[model samples]
Target: MKKSYSIEEINSYLNGELIGTTTHLIEGPEQLQAAKSHHISFIGSIKYAKYWAASKACAAIVNDNLTMEPIDNKAIIKVKNADLAMAKVLELFNPPAPEFTIDIHPTAVIHDTAIIGKGCKIGANCYVGKDVELGDNVILYPNVCVFDETVIGENTVVWSGTVIRERCIIGSHCIFHTNVSIGADGFGYRPSEDGRGLVKIPQIGNVIIGHYVEIGANSCVDRAKFSSTIIGDGCKIDNLVQIAHNSVMGRFCIMAGHSGLAGSVTLGDGVIIGGSASIKDHTTIHSGATVGAGSGVVGDVEAGKTVLGYPAQDARDMLKQWVAMRQFMKKQ
Candidate 1:
């Protein structure tokens, strides 16, 4: 449960208007519907001002331009940007990061040929294969198995049960959560006389994850065929995401939860793929293209385009189609 804060106190905190002990409390706007006497909610637009009186929330954070009659029991905090104020509230409730302790677990089996750097901590039941190189202060949690010839950079952290397959090259400050699989074989099969014959082609290449890349829990990145499966610097991949063979993503891209990209797809810098987006193979998506949630991209996407819906039309076309579908349903 979240700690409570009065609306007047929240407004004071957001506007830097008051220096009181109440700024330490944390609450989200959605919680205001169920919040007790001390909970805080936000009213960013005049459109949502109608909900103000109906909300059980203790306080309302509103934009400066909204002119609404004060609720009988609710307090109001006025701010220039309510969205940024939400970020500040989240920061106050953020969890602390784990620190690197200089101790390797005795249950881990490290090859004598491997080079482990100073202050690195290898966890229990872990396997460090031959010729593996770990940089300074790397932390591998319990049950992590890194195959031969893998290289992890300084200050990187691999969580429990993560498997780094053979010949993987990862950069500094990368974080791999539990059960993340790197360098796994890509989907390659040729249909046969017998019900689509399942033939397997070996993934001969490795995965190259650049600096500050974060792969969430249960995410699997397939190895390449001839080159590396490259994730550029500062790319953040959400949980259960699948990145197939030879996929090259440029810097600072965000792949939301459950999104899957087929083999050989190339994404330019800063592309944003929303939740559950599916991009077919061999397609190129230019920089700054925003693929909306549940979009199915079957072809190349131009730069600066926001595509949505199945087959992924332009944003305008997608909206028009939605309007038509709703009208057709009414007629029926």
Candidate 2:
């Protein structure tokens, strides 16, 4: 079981009012009908507030202004921001995994020129190529492969089967899950002199990942042709996301699962790309912009605007299209 906290403690941490305490167990509304005596839950959004009446959880962190008809057994921890409270709770409960010993497994093959730092753990069947530099407390899980000249910073963990190519620089405290490949060749093939053949343009660049980034399983980020492909600090990238060559993602940008960015795309700070959103090459999403699910962004997005749909335009346009489609379907 994870760490437990009293409602009082949690509230104090979040600067909220605490009513009770719960053990370290928690789950979403759909997962648990009734919270156990130790269950810690959350109620931030109005959508989730409806479940408060039926919540059997012992304690919850909620908004200060919200005044729901309180449940008999439920203890409400009122805070200024529920999301921030949840984040703190998550940090306390699900802290980073303990670092393993700095032992290279017997089955692993490390090249003579590789530089493995102190307290790093190279797992079984892993391959570290020549000139790769791993920082202190780095963990390469079983069967992971890192190519030559890669530089991984301190306290980073590369999960199983992940492949990082040459010259990629990953910053400290980053987490990369299974099959995450960085600095791979970009889709930079051009037409050859003979139309029948395709010419491969050399991807002679690297990927630069900033500190505290978390990349989910099977995500692939490609290298640029002449410059670096960049993922900025504090970015969280979900599974199967693809960032093409020369793409620049600003700090705190969130990219959901299956999102794809074509070559040269730029996302400003706080930009959020929803699941399955595919941004076209050369597109620029300004700071605070949001892209809706399955958006095909092809043009520039202004700050704070939400875009959706193919040849992605403003969210208003997408809403009109959705209404028209619904009406057309109903008529048919």
Candidate 3:
């Protein structure tokens, strides 16, 4: 069932400056063009301001700087940032959390030496290897596998089909989405003595993931050949990302979908990697660096630089080259 809130109620929730009357009810949030008399809309930027006058919404969330002509049937709630205010409003209308009863399912196979923490929910077909320690409120969804000696902190949630390999350390409030594989073998090999084939170099190190980190579905973080592969606090890794062995990412790094880092790559704090970008081995990307989508990074990137293209040069330089190429093609 959809919940309805009055204009005054929403204003109180978002601490917004209420404009016009507050008698109408808001069923939910919608875009300006799609909103109806019972729905609320938002205008985050001036680009969408033109639609405000024609919107049929009962109320609209707008930034404090926005100025629109008053409409009789509509109310305006002004906030510091319309986008942030919209996030709060969306939470209010979000569905209730799913309930999980029977903390440990009967079908779960847990080793006798494993320590299950308080308020944990281990679902059906899940496997907890020997000597594993799961902290309080940890929830493992169905078919999840936690290998031997792995330690997971409080309130961490591992979704179905995910695997945490041996001796990994995952911090509190971390989320591992479906099919994520942590601490897999690194792609390391040695030339064989006979020179016929390559010899597999054993991956002896594990992964260390910090608090509030969320790894998206189907991503893989390889175990290091030595020492740990570390993912820093609050990092958000998108789906299908590959974090190679011995790689260390500083706090709050954002890696978009299909982006990857080769072995021993280092990323400083707040680095942003766009979709499908790849950084070569032993490279360092400094803090606040922005790597554009589909870029191929082969060397170290300086702090606060925005790089683009195959060789990943300065974004402005790459744009100029592209423009020159286009002009030359036109001449032909």
- Give the per-residue lDDT digits (tens) of candidate 3, residues 1-332: 87999999999999989988646788899999998899999998888989988888888999999886558978899999999999999998999755566789899999999998999999989999999999999999899999999999999999999999999999999999999999999999999999999999999999999999999999999999999999999999999999999999999999999999999999999999999999999999999999999999999999999999999999999999999999999999
lDDT tens readout by residue for model 2, 91-195:
776656645454788999999999989989998899999999999999999899999998999999899989999889999999999899999999898888979
**TM-score (all chains, Cα) for each model:** 0.81, 0.88, 0.94
Model 2 clashing residue pairs (backbone): 7-21
The alpha-carbon lDDT assigned to residue 307 of candidate 3 equals: 100
The candidates, ranked best first by TM-score, are 3, 2, 1
Candidate 3, 150: how far from true, in Å? Answer: 0.6
Candidate 2 vs. true structure, TM-score = 0.88
User: By TM-score, who's the top model here?
Assistant: 3
Q: Rate the local accuracy (lDDT) of all candidates.
A: 0.84, 0.86, 0.95
Off by over 4 Å in 2: 1-6, 9-14, 20-34, 95-102, 324-332
Q: How many backbone clashes does candidate 2 have?
A: 1
Q: List the residue pairs that clash in candidate 3.
A: none
